[model samples]
Structures are given as structure tokens and as C-alpha cells.
Target: MPDPALLSIKDLHISVGSRPVIEGVSLDIAPGEMLGLVGESGCGKSVTALSIMRLLAEPPMHIDSGSIAFGGANVLDLDGPALEALRGDQIAMIFQEPMTSLNPVFTVGDQIAEVVTLHRAISREVAMARALELLGRVGIPTPDTALTRYPHQMSGGQRQRVMIAMALACDPQLLVADEPTTALDVTVQAQILDLLDDLRRETGMAVLLITHDLGVVSQYCDRVAVMYGGRIVEQAAASDLFAHPRHRYTEALLRTIPASNAPGTELPAIPGTVPPPGQRPSGCTFHPRCHAVVDACPRTMPELTGEPSSDSLLESRRMSLLELNHLSTTYPGAKGAVVQAVSDVSLDIAAGEVLGVVGESGCGKSTLGRTLLRLVEPSGGQILFDGKDLTALDRHQMKAVRRDLQVIFQDPFGSLNPRHSVGYIIGEPLIVHGVGDQASRDARVDELLALVGLPPDAGRRYPHEFSGGQRQRIAIARALALDPKLLVADEAVSALDVSIQSQIINLIAQLQKRLNLSILFISHDLSVIRHVSDRIAVMYLGRIVEIGPTETIMNKPQHPYTQALLSAIPRPGVARQKRVVLQGELPDPTKPPKGCAFHTRCPMVMDICHSVRPVLEHPTGSPTTGQVACHLYQDQA
Candidate 1:
């Protein structure tokens, strides 16, 4: 009645040393179906995918029990030659980090051609031709030039496309993509996802997609299996799981995302963290974090069953906290040129509100955030905070203003000092500001760590000892040390895994409520921006193109750029919509276009857009009190 599974794993038990990682995990991927494996970091999503390919190192990592069946054979029992024959022929894998996965010495084309030659009895020239064809198919521009380029010569997205081309070299029966789009920008992510979907349709290849992004799982995968602490917590059709999650863990995860709730309201976060290997709680691994915990939850594992009667809106009211009037920040470039990193950017963030700024890299969102904190001194315009022009404040005067304005940078590791202990990192703010003595600062550091969901003793450790997510928590603790009224969180959660990303997002929301701190949240992620922001601002090369209520900007985007971004978001379980892929990269800031900077890439570009710059104004019949900078709305005014 149904197509047989292209790949199947039954009763899989994996262990690294004496500690078990994946216990009795089972999964299936039918031909032409996309299966998403989701979980937090260290939850065996990647390990399981590796196990399917027998890629796990033998001594430390061992597969004690399980059968990975593919193409009517048990992959576990295959001999060296047989396994080698199977790999890259019938089954191929695209790893999360292409930089590390691809060899550094070889050209991308040489590597891809090698795979083609190895699998098929083809000449080097034939293989090279096939490699070029694969590159073009995966949307890489100028495949001929790319053929000679090494992995380091390419951008992250380009490298990933090369990885995909190599994976599809043999047109394998099954494709295993592990967190393929995690590090990519949303536009590139959309392109990669689209490429995968297209390849799947054309070749009828099954995809085993593993990722922590629930948004991706919701939109891309046909079926979903949610993993928790190395075990399958829940499995169902993607739509069914989203509509009605049976497990508490699944429900908590779905409810915790910012987009799932109302703007400004605190997100429901899953308490505590996943336990270390072999030290799982006696019965349920998730019992510690489960909000719907029963008394027996700690002693007995609840069978995955549907008994869910529950659920969840976020609308944030406005109260002006900070305002910018024609704010501009610029830097001198080569030969008398000026790079307008941020130009005439005017917006406001309400008290205890998240005003999200979204744009591609180099669109000036990060510069705008820095300008708000006076980290980048505004060359022009006024930055009004509590009715005072921050630009006019002297160094001594600005030092006091700095107490109310703090920032959290994108790279947590880079932002934090390597030589400093966690305690010192968090307490330094208090020390520098003359707020407390050494003993009092230590106590305050502990308190701040607890507030951000880190253990009190985490203060004793160094930054390198902690994971990326933990390091970000430490950064937040430091940001909160000054009791700042406004936080410039520039791409704060962008570097984290999806599950950890949710934790940080929720933590920010929680802190925003606890301290009533206004946030200038800047990121390229539209889904995350829509979830947390009270109002949304879309920026293009050095200028604000649109600003509106979150609902209006996300649901009914008026600006063409905003519309393109929203459409690019990969929603799970839905057929890929016809997206407006903005052609070409971001324009050079030093030499921008004559009028609207976005006109070059805009699909609905008009003659007027090329000659006259648009201003932020209420679009005709706009449902909300939002503004757009577009010629399309010019007549509406």
C-alpha cells in the first residue's frame, strides 16, 4: 500500500565509552519522504545520523545493538569493501560544517569529481564535467570558476552548496543532511532547502534531515521525530505533531518558541538542562524540565500517548523608551570614500519592548544597534534617550548614560575575555562602576548567574570551559550587571543551535520582563524576529526601509524586501512557496545606488525607484500604524 522505507534503523543502541548516548532509537525514511530528526545539542541527533552511515569511530564509540537497513541489506553487518561500495553510491551524507568536512588541500571541483569518478567508472574529464553540472544545479554561480576554487575561497553558503553537489554526485538513494542550514543566512538557507527539495523531487531520493530548528522541521520535513537525551520522545507526521504534541517535552518545545506566543509576553521556557551522559535521571530524562510534571514523572517514564488538552497570544503595548531622529553613523574608506554603515536610521523602542531589526549582512542593522549605545559615535542626527540628546553628551556625561545602555555582541567568545573567570567577567561591570566591594561583587555575580539560568558555581569556571550557549548566558549576566534600561542585542542568539537558541531567546524575554528592559534586537532571522518583537524594522543598505507592528510586518508585509524575507522562511510540512529570491548580494555601502538602495534587487522595481528615494510613511490601507519606505506606497500618502 505504501512505498517501502529507503532507510530504517531498529533498536539502535550507541555508546561512547561506558556511557550510552542513543538508546533503543528507531527511525524510518520512506522513498521521496523527508524525515527530520530534532533535539538539543548532545542529544544524539548527529550521532544517530552518523551511526546510519557507520561513521562512528570504533573504540570509543560502539554500536552495541541495532540494525541499520538500507537497500534490502543491514548496513551494520557489511564488510569493509561492501560498506565502502555502499557509501557515496547508494547513501551519502552532508555534514553540518562543510569547512571541516571538505578537505583543505583539494579544489572543490577536484573533490566532487573524485566522488563522481569513484562511484561511477568515469574518466577524470567526465567526472569534472559532472561536477560542474552539479554545482550549477545547486545554484552556485559560475561553476567553471568555482571548479578551481578551494573550500576556503568560498562563503559559508557556497561551501555548503559544494558539499551538496558532492553528496548528490552519485544520485544516492538516500541523502543524510545533518544541520545543513544551521550556520547559513536565512536567504542562503532558503536556497539550500529549496535545492534539497528540488533534488529530492527530481531524483526521488529520500532525505534524512537532522536539525534543532523546529521552524525548519515544520516547513521542510514530511515526518518528524523529536529526540530527547538520546531517546525518541515523540514521532508523528509533521503537521500532526505541530497541531497536537502528546509529550510534555514536545509541547514545551513548541510553546517555547517566540513566534508561537504573543509579542512582549514572556516565553514559557523548559526548566533545567539536559543531563550528562550515563547520569540521566532515574526514569524520565525530561522530568526535571517538564512543566506538566506529575509526581510519578520522576520515577516512571511516561509512554508517548495523546492526552493533551492545552495550549496558548503575544501583543505588546507601546511605551516610548528610546528614540532616534535621523541617526547616522559613517566610516571613512579608501581614497576619500565614506562607508555609510548606518544612515538616517530613525526608529523607537518602547520600554520593556523588543524592537527587532532584520536585514542581510552589511545592511547596517548591527551598526544601528552600536550607534544607539554610542559605541559608534553618530556622525549626524540626534539619539534621544529619556528626552536627552546622547550625541551631545561629553565623555563624562556619556559614562553615566552608559549605565542605562548596554550591549551583547554576536560572538560570545569574542565578546568575553579569555583571561577572566566567569565571576570576574560578570562582576567587572559593578567594579568599574563603583557599585560594590569585591565581596559584594562576587555575591552579585552569583545572583546574576542564577537569574540567567546558570548554576551558581558556574562563576568559578572560565569561558573556554563552557559551551557556546553557556557562554552567551554569561554575556547576558554581564549585560544585566549594570541594570541597563535598554539592551543592544546584536545577533545574540544567531550563533546558537536551535534548542539552545530557544533557551537564549526565552531567557532574553524573561529578563526583559523581570527588569522591564527595552531591547534593540538585531538579527537576520525573520521567524525569531516575528516571535519576540513588539514592532519590526526592515533595513536595506544603511537605511530603514520599513517599520511596523510585528503582526503587520510579518503577516502582511508591505515592503518588497520584508515580503521577500518572510517568504524565504522555511516552514515545515508546507510545499515550498514561490519565493522572491533577491538577486545579487548586498550593494557596496561606500558607493550606493542613486536613489533607493534596494531598487537594484527589488522584483517590482519602477523608474521612480531609480530616481527618488522613499521615506517611511503609512502605506495605503495598512491595517496597523506602521511605515514603509517604498515608491509603491507613495501615492497612498
Candidate 2:
């Protein structure tokens, strides 16, 4: 059943410096449910969140015309005192980046206590006690000691928890969480997600979650609203939207995420960048970059409909391109401790595909890719490439296959040496494989640079001389130099901005088709995985709990843990309610849970989950449903 509206906005028109930043936007947030707002960066997502709190500053910006209703009262029309009363006492918010939101100089405890006392009229002693309890409720260990610690002293995850505790301290009916987990590690992100889910069940508060990630929308939000140029272009129930996104923009978003089934399908990005506010085109804002764009799309806007065509209705589905069999990697930790990153995980990748692996920091997505290339010795497992056993090859023997395999790492600048120019970096690979000498290598480097959308002369520039995006281009050139069939990318674009990230993703896509190079793109970004991979694998501490086609895993994630991790991505450009942001911290890898790695934080945890760990198994009814290890899929109730 549809939830009743808790907050509503109509004719929302906002601007910065006489420019229309948000235009004619309207949305609804229902009671005890989350509405996900999503789009790319600068799509007015943050601005919309600010407008809800009546927090837009003057001069450069203002809400020209809009009716923002909270508890049936027009919040935009409220006076300062009335608004302040509503903020903590009625509606609370958790902004993006808690480090910036928190006062660094003050103790975390005092900050939270201040909110409680100011809103509740409680004594300082009572407020402090309440603050400590809230802290504890948010799952912060040593809540009392944590209170005295400053914002800087705490990790990014802790600060977020503190922010949540403070927001909830007022017992507000609405919670607005804006990209709360964008910068967190996988494990920390998992803990935060679990906590948020718990809080939502307990408080019955409405949640408005804003983010750019579709996976989060699929898992956490009951309904999703996709934003483009400050307007909702698409919205529907989470399952319906993910299963059958109407707008071309929404479909493109789903395609961008990496998957586990198809190991190296090139990620398809929406063509072109999201235009800046000032430069927005007329009619349908997404028409400019949409491949399925029609002549009418440029002159007429598409409305947010309740229905859209499902993916299965499409004429054809993407085929697979790569595969991994019995792949395993064990890393040695302190004092004889062995951390099995990818333990005997076997999966296949068909022609022209991407298999996206997702999990917390230590979940082994990156490790699996490395072990495939023998970068890390697989203690046990078979890595078959085109029916040939990779495990049998020595470094020298593997060198023959190295020309068909490549790797792109995160932090491109760190990967390239400062002393050598971009030309040298890309050329080194060609020279190593005896393909070309100095002059030929130089020519090849220039061609590669041009292929990656950089100028020919860019080859002469030093690593430090270019921006993050440009350096990454150089890194790609280096990876492609060997002209390998497979490319392994380890957190390749996580540190980049949205605009730059899209550009890099597009470049990779173009290059992949042109060269037929299979890629192992690794990252913590679920949206990227969805857009890129044909299939997705959700990893926990080390094992992959869920593996399925992109549509299945994303639209109806069988595993509870997969659902939570998907709920963590930040959707940009939409205005919706926040969710149980997420809960708790990642469990310790050295001291993992006894049975299911995720059982410690699982929402639908069972008794057997704590004693007998489940293996990566396929559903009996549908053998091709892909592999999911969770007991949820086991019973299929």
C-alpha cells in the first residue's frame, strides 16, 4: 500500500544569482517510508535539501516561489522562530559530510546536548544524559568517552552516527539524510546502514534519502524519484522503477553499475555530462545526452509516470564477456592470521559483459581481480581465461597473456611517476612487450592519449601538471598500451568528481568496444557497478553473498545484506525523504561473526544463520537466477 504524505512541496522554484537552479519541482514524502531523490552532481539535489530546512542564504540565492509543507503547514511561509521550532522539535536533518556539519572545536557530546536542551527545554544534566543515550542508541561504543571527543578525533563513520543521533535526539517526525555515506569505507558503510534501518523501524519517522546511486534506491527506498535539471523525470515504487525504468535517464543509470555475473561488460554511461544549471536546454532536460532521444524529446518534457517498460521487454539483453573459476586469495595479516579475501569463488562472464563485484572495504572485489592476474598468489583456485588455466602459468608464461590483460588502479596520480611524462608512462607497456622502441613507443603513446580524449601534446606533460581526470587518462593509456583482452581496474575512479567520473567511464566504454578489451573494473560505487556490469556480486568481509544479473540483483536483491549495501549510495538531482540512513560499523575481519559474515547485522537474521554458514548457491526453481548465498533466497517463501 502507498504511504500517506508526510511532507509536500509544490511549484518549487529556486535560484542562485538570478538563475533558475530548481524549476517547478514538486514531490511528496510519506509517513514511515523513504522517498529516494537521485541524479548526477549539481542537479539541485543539495539545493532542494537546503530549501526543505528553510536554510537557503540570501543575495545570491532565494526561493522565488514554492510551498513547502511539513505536517500540513507550509514551512516556506513560516517565520524564523516557527521554523526553528520545527527543525529539531518536528523535523531533523543529517547533511552530507558530517565532518563539515560538525563543529570541530567543540566536543561531540556538547554539540548533541545543545540540540536536545534548546529544543526540549530540558536541564543541561538531562540533555547531556539524553545525548549520551542517543549516542549509544546510534551504536557508538564507549558513548560517554565519545562525547568528549571532537569531530576531528572521530572517523567519518562515527561523525555520521553522531550527526544521526543529534538529529534524532529531537524526536522529529521527518529525517533528511543527504549523501551521508558517500565517503565512507565499505565496512563502516555497512554498519551505518544497519543502524539506519533499525532506527526507521523504531521511530516510524518519514525518511527523505538523496543520492546518485540507484542501488540504494532499489534497496532502502520504497519509492524512487529520478531528477534531471531540477525536475523529477521519473518515479515509481522501488521494485517497479528498478525493474522497469521508463525514462531513458533511469535505464542508463541502471546500466552504469558494475555487476558480478558478466565480469567485464563495458559500463554504459549516459552520453555527455549533466549540463550546468545556467546552460540547461529547453524541454526534456535529458534529451541532449540520451541515446534513445527523439525529436520531440528536445521540445517536450516527459512526465513522471507510474508505469514504464520492464527490461525483459527490451528486444535484446547484453551478453557476457569474461569468467572466473575457483578463484581464491588469502592475505597474511598480523601473527599467522590469514584473511581469505575471495574464497573459492567461481563465476562465469560471457561475451561483451561486465561482472561487478561490490562489498565493504575488505570484501575482496579488488583482491579477486588481482588474483586473476596473479598479482597476488591465489592460495588455491582455478582462473580460466578462454578455457586456458591461468593458474598453471608462471610469471614468464603469463607474460604472453599479459598483452591481453591490463589493470587500472585508483589514485591515477599516485600510479604515474612524476619524473616521467605521460608519454613515458603509456609507452613503457608497449616497450616492455617488445612491441615498439623509443620512437614507436612515443607515437603509440600519442595515439593512446588521443584515444582517451586527451590532446596529442598531453603526452609531454608531467603527472603533477594535469588535473585528477587527466592523470587518470594517462593511467588508462598505460593500461591499454599492452593491448590486452582484459583490464583490471582497482577503485579506478572513486576519488574523482562526478563530471570527471562520467568522462572517465565514457572513455573506458569507447575504448573497450574499439579494442574488444575485457575489463575488471573494481570500485565501491554501486551506481557505477549497475551502470557498467551485466551482473553484480555483493561481497561481505571477504565472500560474495549475492551474484546475479544486474536487473535481478538490483531490482529485487534476494540477500538482506545486498539490499542494505545497495541502500548506501547517494542519489543526486532529486528531492525525496531521507531513510534509516544505515546502521552500525563493519564487523572486525580478524574476529568475524561465527557463521554468516553478515548475520551479525542482518535484519532478517535466523538461528541457522548463526551456526551454519551458507555457501554461494543458486535457486533451485530458477537455476539461472544466478548465485545468492543468503538464506532469504534459500527458502523462497
- Say which candidate scores most in lDDT: 1
In terms of TM-score, how similar is model 2 to the real structure?
0.49
Off by over 4 Å in 1: 1-319
Give the residue spans of candidate 2 off by over 4 A: 1-322, 573-583, 620-624, 635-637
State the C-alpha lDDT per candidate: 0.85, 0.77
1-637 per-residue lDDT for model 2 (tens digits)? 3444678887799988878999888777766777788999978888888899888887689889989888778998788899888887788889888988999889999999999888887799999999999999999989999989999998889999999999999888988889878898878877876677778878888788888877666778877777888887766668756765656777778888775126777677677888887899987888888776544456656444221222211212222234566677877878988777777687765433456778778777888888888888888878777546888988798888877678888899888999997788889877778885678677777778877888988887889989999989889988977656578878888999989999998888766554445566687888998887767878887777888888898887778777777777667776644532335667766677887878777878888889778878886566567788876666633
Alpha-carbon deviation at 366 in model 1, angstroms? 0.6
Candidate 1, 1-637: lDDT as tens digits: 4556667788899998999989888777778878888888878899999888889999899999989889789999999999888899899999999999999999999999999888789899999999999999999999999999999999999999999999999989999999999999999999999899989988899899999899988998887888998898877678767864656678888988888999999988778788878889977788888765544456556443211111100011122468799999999989989999998988776555689999999999998988888888899999988667898999899988887789999999999999999999999988878986888778778878888989988998999999999999999999988778789999999999999999999999877755556799999999999878878999999899999888888888888999999989999999999998889998889989987889999999999888888878887665567899998987822
